[model samples]
Target: MAREGQESPLLKVEGLAISHGDVPITLPLEIVVERGETIAIVGESGSGKSLTARAIVGILPPGINAKGAVTLDGVPLMRLAERELRTIRGSRVSMLMQDPFTMLNPLMRSGDHIDEMLRDRPEFASRAVRADEVKRRLAEVGIVDEDVARRMPFQLSGGMCQRVALAAALARDPELLIADEPSTALDVTTQAEIIKLLRRIQRERNMAVILITHNLRLAFSTCQRIYVLYAGSMLEVGDAAAVERQPFHPYTLGLLLSEPPVDIRVPRLVAIRGSVPRAADVIDSCGFADRCEWAKQICRAGKPSLAARDASRFTACIRQDEIQGELDALRSATLSATPETPRRGGTAGALVHVDALVKTFAGRRGRPICAIRDVSLHIMAGESVGLVGESGSGKTTIGRCLVGLETPTDGDIRINGIAAADFGAMAKADRDRVRRTIQMIFQDPYSTLNPKHSVGQALREALGASAGAPSPAPQERIASLLAEVGLSAAYATRRPASLSGGERQRVAIARALAVKPAILVCDEPVSALDVSVQAQVLNLFRRLQVEHELSYLFITHDLAVVRQIAERIYVLYLGEIVEEGPTERVISNPQHPYTRRLIESIVRSAIQRAP
Candidate 1:
């Protein structure tokens, strides 16, 4: 940490206010970051975490209003002209966005994009020197191969793309780095590697960093200080350890309580009730008052200013004193809920059985690249089976094959004793019946949903297909589906874009359940959601499995999530099942090296968290 009176802060913001269209999103806020310090802005979707980062980059979308003074090294950033800010953007301050695939130019070669940044500099007169520098930067981020750098953006995996983007951000050696959910989409091992890389770079460069994310564990592990944002307001600010040990605000407590336990026998996940309030609904009142269990009459009537709770902690809650006891109780409950014993039973009932599954894709050079080779596994009915792997490990390819979206090169997939190959060549009626027996939930809900259609239309379309026609009153079914997924009925008429990420995901779940399928192939379903929303979705999956006797082929990179729900787990590596056993046994006492690495990564992440 920087001394208080040593020098002026590296970055400072005061009286920051922002709006989207006609609604104010972020209220007047104050924050600062000193050289060699990292600050994490933690919040759920629509909490103004990403918006704040965008505001600093001067890349906020149109119809957004910002009023604040953002200064860097004593120079006012908001006062600078557009051209001036452009000069400072890549050379002085750089941002690493959430999704690297969308951030990178798809048409450009990966190496050329980094070289382009160097070519723009007047000092880089030699092409060979720039090329060497690009390779060195890529190597610095753990990507040492020459072939990866030469490949196009689309040719790389999501993890590889993220590393390329990080290299691009470091091409200019910016003084400040803004990483926004940098590891959200990555597997546990990849996420650990990225976090380690960022920390190493920051230490070596002594660059100030602003880490924005909804994952409290990630933030606490990487950042020294954390700021909790709720409904556009800064609810609390303090040292990460202090905040985690003794959260001062209701919202902060809610966030901490919402994380799912790593232990399998832990029953009853902690959930924060209600959704985040919209910007238009925010007023001069406690942002979390609506969902706060300890909210009082004063909490809803007036806003609370940040008050010093300790030497290093501050909170914006009128009932902080009264809530501390309840927060402590919740924390105790959370700790007690983690069980010492592991779950039993694995590889039974044969809900989904595959043999010699194979899928090959054409590489850039037109050579056949085997994605999955001779992969086989069995998932039991009413059982949760986890598919674990890093990117390019073919977990998703097998998932796609099981869902009938892609044809396997050679293999057999049996769901409920029905072979996938036989089901594929079956008549249209038989195929439709097989499809109705199994449904898939994709990773990107926003892309999966039709933008032009309302929730009702999407649900009705899916159910109508299974029902063979539209029901007499589809509205009630839509409402019931929403309720089944822990969403409000009022959301039935809303468009996909109009809903939060959690809400949109709930709608996706509802669409999958509309067919009354006995099996669900979830591909990273909760990876895009925050920890709170993730817990809710995990519990929902568990409940639906119990109620409907549904079997889940859950494919995810997050082992913590897998531990919570999966009865059995299959560890995939480079298109093969290297290890298979009960979830607890596979995760806790792994025999394969890859499985051991994954377990080590998860333990490292958890242990590195501020205590």
Candidate 2:
């Protein structure tokens, strides 16, 4: 069937707004999608992008009031009853939720998920036909093995779980698909594979897709049009090409420029200065005015109306015409922030060393699963080492074993010339000394922090574990620690639930530094943050390393971040070290095929992008 004329869009949203208990979650917004079009809704975290999506699909949480007009193929979604809306979900529209581990049921096998989705379909009522269709759908998403269908979500890797989620979504056979942060936790190569798979399926089925992600690169490269939102309001909407080349909204421009350019000349990154405002603040005036460099008094007084400049572009800035000059000047200036720091305490000998390390787990039927196999690496004092690999390659397991969370099955780990085995068996004083010497900054900050404790209490507890006489007043030291992490003393009283992801991570770092550790094992610290926040945290790491003379064992799946932070690189594959060398040499001329493919996969992900 041919697409309808532009007179009728496949999915149309007009004046959509959401509120919870008199607080605005999203301002009045408008969106339109033609048949077979893939549109991107891009913004930073807490910008209301996901809230808008939830409202569109009628899945908003309790107490949240959704006021909008949503139409799909001339059917009024907002007007539908609960029973009516539920019927249209899988057959008419399907949503591929973010974080498959949470979205999917852990108790059920992967095959059961597909079966549940297909159960509603008329063609697969028979058991044998449904079983065969399950395998077929899984193969379409790149999971070709039938054995994978029997495994529960907890048994599969992050990338494999994502493919299973995609396969389940496809089984619904909907006319429209909403992929919410589909590639968020995935590594670059795995992310690329998922993106490619989605695009291919979209084209093959000629289905309209709504891609909800904070990644600007994905917005520019994968979608036909982009809608930029800030604090619940639509700031800009335009064709991806025009918007990427010359964005009218200041927030949009800032988001694009915040990404570190691959060019050597642009060594520093200019981060957006402020974070998103509170829900109450967003309801009164322009939510981004305080953060935008070009804001005027009028901008904060009242909200700016979205005005169309042409048939294909719209912007909400009242002074959109004046923003270009400011942006141009910002582009030409050398970055104001120092993104890199010189090696602070580089020593002749290694600070932490591993020799023939191995970690194995007992699998089903008592089979041994080797997570780490004879991996040996070292980091010098004040030097940063990158441990890069796909999921299940043991990058995190190494960090755990080095930190003594896991006992090494074989080989040795030496921290400051003390063997891990000896350290574990040492006297109480010696163990305390080792704990102070080496500490870990976990990947998820909230999980590491206690919900019952305030930030001040957390810091104070670190001080209480003192290796010396207590300071005169712990409050002064707590304030100092907060300041060192770029947070104010006010943050000390705030609990973990009140802080943002970036703020929580900073607190995690401050707590680690409170013990004055000689070395920090940072495990994907910035992976959970937004792009702008990620830059800020990375810059903070460099500055702290210089100030405290610290060494870091940085484990991450993002090769780009590893390239920026690590001096040396180790590429792991299937629990074995496949490649190891200086960061530059390893990235440019990788020796192993796995390393080379990892590099190429990232490059190929940008198959289409705005110049």
Candidate 3:
């Protein structure tokens, strides 16, 4: 509420509901952003976090219907026409998306992207003026190299592309900036840098920002307030520090526990029991009732309204007062619990060993560039080994080499005491037998999964391709495979497009297990998943490893994630193994400066908050 003559909020959303056709995507929600304030809208995929951001910017996809009163600077945006909204966009509000590469034009130079945003402005009237502004904008984002202006999007790294994207968004000096998962795709160090830069720019410009992300750590580190959404409804809204310290909703608590703490190791991440409900599956009752441990019979009675818990906090839970003590106890118990020490020495001989591995690619101007240089590591049978590095640091390349996706330029890869190259010279059956011992799981399961094929069909194909004798009942085998990865038989009937991100990854895992592989090369498998979903997947990996006698070359950029799953850690920097030791030692006492930076980059939301 504004005073009688005072101006309205810089951005105000009231009773906002979004739907596609007859199915509701998000329930009526409210948000208020004052000038120079930062607020986060946090939730898993399909929880309508991104949809809310899109709605606020008047850029919802076709067939999506948004009903609400959205005002910017006292102007009714929802009532405005497309032409009218176009003028307001970039000038009043700008959006920075998750994938900077997707937003940027690959054919155009970085400077041209910024120039287009400033071309219509009176200040940048001439080409020379616009060019100078472009350089200034790029420099503001930490890209000071003048040559970056001429470089195409493909020429720059992921972090550089993100910086350029931010430059274009800030080109118009919008009063409000909506950054939706802006740092999710980058590495830890790059992610921290981008967020720091965004915060600095926001304060310098006195701009209000709506930071939409699934990461509670990121939200708490960068935002002043957090709004937790579950199954399209806002469950909790409070100060970022207050929410991190004590969540009012069970869903918020689950999210906090789901994140692997860098400072303390827990036995297992407390994953939510089930995946988030789809818009069509959402009912009138509490959306989190199925997964909430404290859910009571009355929780399923009807939808709860967001009620004030305190002067600065709001929660949708009806039993907040009754459950506060228990929730706090659980939180304390989970965080301060005995550390799960890495069990070292209970594994068979090395299953996969790479000695003097070197992989080179043809660089620009026909120059040779080494991707993996003298990298040596071994994964013991039934042991999980982590390969941690930033983007372009040969983490994925090594995973690819281990899975036979790429051949080493100059090195020897021995699998089960036999050279990988020698397997090709052996009999066809022997070669096939050795090949089936290693399987790879990619980051984006959708790209690897066949959209046209059902989960059952994909698993069946993998089963048939293996050299082993045919199963007595292929259907039973497929079901068993699905069960191993925490999916039910019914999931077999669903296509990749119909499943959630976590479910699809489960299907991918089932398919990999279909070959009865001894080693699984997991490459950033849970990087993009929500914290709860990532926890579920990581736990599944640990369970499957013991049950099936599997070894993993877990490749990821996140030390926190790797700490939860890996027994040994190898830190890779610029295609070289800079540090290698036990997971606990590497994390606690990093020998390399690069390794220390990676650990420091982790956003420890459980222990820290925004100042």
Candidate 4:
């Protein structure tokens, strides 16, 4: 326990409930954070992690009702008026959102956003002083150049934009800092740097931080205490290390088992079965009972309150003892298994092949930046090949080059024995045919689907523009496409704004499939989605590929996703392919130093519980 001081226990919450349009999305929740302490809220998507944070900040979306006691130094946030809440927003508690691009004003320069946060501060009254402070903050977050700070949000990379946002949020030095999946949008290296920066900031300022995320490893690595939420209810809470070492709840145990082990190669991931229950569903029983292997009749009868499983750990599951034993046996078995090398085997026929691929871009001072260098690989006609790397490792660039968005400076790209250069030199009609064979599904579905158009309209435009010859009626095809992506035909009339994050992604996938392409370029497709939704999407991708014989060039930074679908894996580093082998082998053995580092980092994260 942390020692109490005048400014200790910066924030505390009790029985927080949030509803959307009369539907309760989250159940009663509770959390606490002391000055200079980090509290991590961990759960799968739809687990109500983000909603809990929003409730604390008094920023629940329209039509959402929040009932709770949120206190900051004994001041009741729920009782405060909107006008009063605004004054405390940045000055007392500030938030760094998941996507910096969305949080920032696109029309304004990066420096301006930081300056705006510090506008009322007496020390920043002078323009020159403000500029210097902004630059210093930028530099502290790994952006070393003044020119980079002057650019607009759109002009900067995702990592750079996030750094600028962090600088802006820290400008006020608020008493409480709420970081909602701050590193989700960044690459692995950038994610590490951001975590380190947050730790330093917390230590230096003694600010209470509410870190909300689905990544258990990240939470264990950085937070002092861990609060596991499921269906908007607190499932468990304990010291980070203690809870991870001996997870008391079945949900927490499932989450721990689901994560790929560090030292040994497990045959298959132990995924929790079933999807997260919808917001409209009744929360009468344990939220995790449906998917729990050890669930008993009592678990389904009624919701369970958090009960002490030991001196320090509290769990809400009725079968915690039984599940704990099972989890222990599984962990021991996993740790004892001998690591095996990964092998590749799949469908026949080569769909795409790259030989000595190289891409270079001009840097700020006329220096050359090697984006992809001497990369070689092959993807079968009906296989899903994963490309994994930290940020700036050329994963996105490779995807871009394959989709013809960027012409590679040097390399031979062959699609079905036809060279890309030869295809580029062919007639327009021939080029169009080749282009239709491959399509890309972007990371953010909302951005990919135009807000102005309905789902039906978007599909129609993509089909009409990309498909060579239209044989079927547009309406029928649109309906079929929606059904194929697990959406109802009635959704055709709705715009992207009306859909959930998962629904919008399904629409994006449907739009990509409108042309019936042979291959799909999925770039971080599930990174932005909730875990349960991610599972559904992954299953959908697999089903689609098997049913349609579709090939995939899957690019992502997440190794767990790669292990799920990818048979062969290519590990990139600073635009170079450092390792290439079967997914299991690369992850377990990890021949390359960078790959080893990544694995070690993940292991270290898992072992080091919060605080």
Candidate 5:
């Protein structure tokens, strides 16, 4: 831990450059971490935030070459050999990786990993002391049980695994902690718990923290200062509160506008059009010039240097002053850009109906766990219905059951005037009809998409049996599907792993549309997406629903998202529908206590505190 009243900053990074062969990933970056202060390196995906962290920790990939001067308390980390770096890794400085599930050892028990982190410390010399410390750390992070400690990473929920990862990282009491997208995959409430725990632990230990995330909300919630990165370059840096009020850079402002707000009447989110430029595609001009609406000839001719804008604030935009002057006017234009009104569900007959759906899974010791208990809901033709609750409240289960992924213990599911159970039992030709009209879009696109299959191949597989006699041919079908989901036809040959998260999700949506489903069952579709991408995907979903006249059974834990997309909402608690009403009525005046708590859990991106 950093000593209180120590003179110099906890860490310093200067003249940092990272490159893979001739391609530059990051250019001449500079950052300073004061003792016990939290700083956020915020950006969208592919902004080189993780690459910066990897360079600091001396784990740059084999093909990558890093040229930087990174010092921790006057000691140069770049000069250190591998063995020396390893010694300093967990003791003086440590890293908590982005995906906790992948970072943790699936073979080892949770407590074992925590104990191993402190194995080299003299303070934890004995086994008994180490065991006690393990329990204490686990409890500190809200995983307070001997049984929990013994469980493997696969046995724990995403939230619990994240807590275990945190416990392990703090085990050695490192002076600097680098958390890379710490709570990315967790739900809102679990994310809140992790956020509070991180703040408390940082205060208790007086340790400096470097939080790397694409999440602006999480960044504002924790960091004292924010450095916004764009396409491997630092675009803006300022006090969190100051930047929140007035962002100097157009990219930063666009990012803020892209955020999904809890309270706003904006027609649609202001998306920064175009994708993140690849490192190899670097040009002499500003990296964001192509996407920025205010870009002029000068912005497209030369790169801007990081210059002072105001007190303790700097931005790398040549027209920062001009943009700052018209912030309100530009924002008003974005908010005033009207979206096509979502056609509400008229007094039409129900297209998909569920009556007292009950699903029970085999539990420990032969006890049945009721995942769905008398939960009843319906989606009208050309309408959208949402099911929202906490992570384990059976939202996904209900979705799976409705789409025929899971067999309900007892219930009546009617889709397009036909009994869903009977359709499942129908002959081959009849079963194909159900599959073509009622499709499911899963939560994790990475896992749902086949790694071995190209985008075209994945689409062709989905179109099987349904595309009888191949009216459009597989290639034509693939091209049309890609275009429908806002991707270029050239993306057909690209593999899932090569695509960005948003692009992969678009592919997932395309695959679902291959069979031309009339109703979509989307499970937590945008929960794990970056805010900007979430806005884009949400907007895309709205457009697709309108074009296809699609009915939706959207299951998610995000109240804000559901409020925007769903016409009617059902709040699930312990596998039961605790509250049901129109989206506006439920959000404005939530009736049930559980439903109110869920609504309250909707965290705002920015929080203002007393100066």
Candidate 6:
């Protein structure tokens, strides 16, 4: 399918299928990557994005098998032996995983990791030369700190660890790089820097790249082409700009609409209804039929084929043309709609107050590291206050201090007119009374919930520990709590591992609500979720706020998400509050330089995608 005078693709995937044991996980798929080109494979979690990448690299777990043809530079990889594949893995094609901290060896130094990759190469004839190359590679990835070479993985920051990982991946100067969710763990500013560095390296080396991610907007910003996948099937493929401007498949359009725009604020984000179907449940029909609003009976009659819409576009939907028209109308209606005016709250006295709060930790060689300075803030009853900052900016530290996870070094914290310091000194009943009034929801809900307990058991345990007077039976109360978070009572029988990311978060919220807390401290609750799932959770938060009249301390690095949920915003940098004001005012006219820099890193592709 090459044009005249064009070279064959650097990588070609034809009729590629993956299976575990006897059950097939992915259908036959095709992908092509030209030399020096960047393409994106985008979808939500469990869409086979990661599995496909693993299959291509011959790294699937035991019992999983990959079939069909995959070629790099006209060399077939399907029939290659394990020893042969090892020879081609790092020298010709390299991969970077999602979490660098976990991927890297904690015992080894940063420079040592890269040195090991180059140890087998003949180009570096001496240790001195290899040492110099290690520094050069680190500098190539924007890590200029010479001391990073000697420090362990835990000693480095998240950004620095990721840069080291990138340096190691490029040790052999591979022809192709596979970066899987590269920036999902870093803050906004660090993510932008990493992506910029990646593009620069790809261009300098003329290497091809396959970016796999759950974020469509992120993929569009860095890639020339995008392939949208859903329920283990490829749904759409097109030029990045073409897909952004006019996505053909209903699922693709839904993904585009789910993204929260940084340039403008909306009353509610457009969410795709329903969760992705489980792999076992996917039938020989449209994978998105359950969630597609315009689906007809024909959609479920048989599986649709990927048909060409134009020279550069293909979609797996029989109703693409019809759905495109409906999408255009919806965009028009959204553009013409009046913006909703948000109500300002916090007229009552402060329900939670911290004065001269300070927290410090022991650093290397016993030096003191101040996590938070003499920072002070308050939240009034029934108000949502956002705490915005980068990873090491002390946002999580403050949240922990507020919820009794960590005792403050120096400060005064009062909850509902009671001194937080007196909690330990008070009677067990009194301490429970004050603690039950406030609850904290962590970033990973699965980690917080006990995996062995069913959802009903978890909720029952929480209800049993309540200090307040009980009025309902345990089962009845559990059902009510689940329903409050938009979940059915049947979910109570399922364990945490059986639920999706969004579903687990909903269960976590229900558990937090079991004690009838007046305030909730949510810490980056939706950062790792898909856009559609994130919107659903955000909407659930809004509804819960109104129904329970609960105050919220929403902490996140995403400005768009904060603007949607928080009434007032506090921008934190280096353990200090740089700016604080109404969400609109602060985001529109940031006074602090740090706040402005944070805003600049936000990707505004959602607004730019439309006219």
**Candidates' RMSD to native:** 2.7, 2.9, 2.0, 4.8, 3.0, 1.5
Lowest-lDDT window of 10 residues in candidate 6?
A: 333-342
What would the per-residue lDDT of candidate 5 be over residues 504-594, giving only the tens digit for each residue? 9999999998888889999999887777888899889888988999989998888878866888889998898999988878877988998
Query: Global lDDT for candidate 3?
Result: 0.88
Candidate 2 vs candidate 3: the TM-score winner is 3
RMSD score of candidate 3 (Å): 2.0
Which regions of candidate 2 are displaced past 4 Å?
Answer: 1-7, 261-267, 332-345, 469-472, 603-611
Give lDDT per model, in order. Answer: 0.83, 0.83, 0.88, 0.81, 0.84, 0.88
Per-residue lDDT for 446 in model 5? 95
Which is better, 2 or 6, measured by lDDT? 6
Compute the lDDT of residue 324 as modeled in candidate 3: 93
lDDT of 3 by residue, 61-126 (tens): 999999989999889999999999999999899999999998899989989999999988887899
Root-mean-square deviation of candidate 1: 2.7
Model 3, position 253: C-alpha lDDT score? 89
Better of 2 and 5 by lDDT: 5
List of clashing residue pairs for candidate 1 = none
lDDT of 1 by residue, 1-611 (tens): 23366688888888888987668999888888988899999999879998899888788888897999888888898988899998899888999999998779999999987998888787776998888888898999999898987899988888889999999998898999999999888888988888899999999999989999887877878889998988899999999878877787878877776776554446766778777887558677888888888888898787788887767788898888877898777777666654634333344667678998999888767999999989988776677789998877998898888878888888888776666755458678667877888899988899999999999899989888784654547888888888898888888789998987777888998999998898899999988888788778777887877777788888987777788788888999999899998887887688999888887776223322323
* Model 1 worst lDDT run, 10 consecutive residues: 602-611
RMSD in angstroms, candidate 6? 1.5
Which candidate's TM-score is highest?
Answer: 6
Instruction: Name model 6 segments beyond 4 Å from true.
Output: 1-5, 335-337, 426-430, 606-611
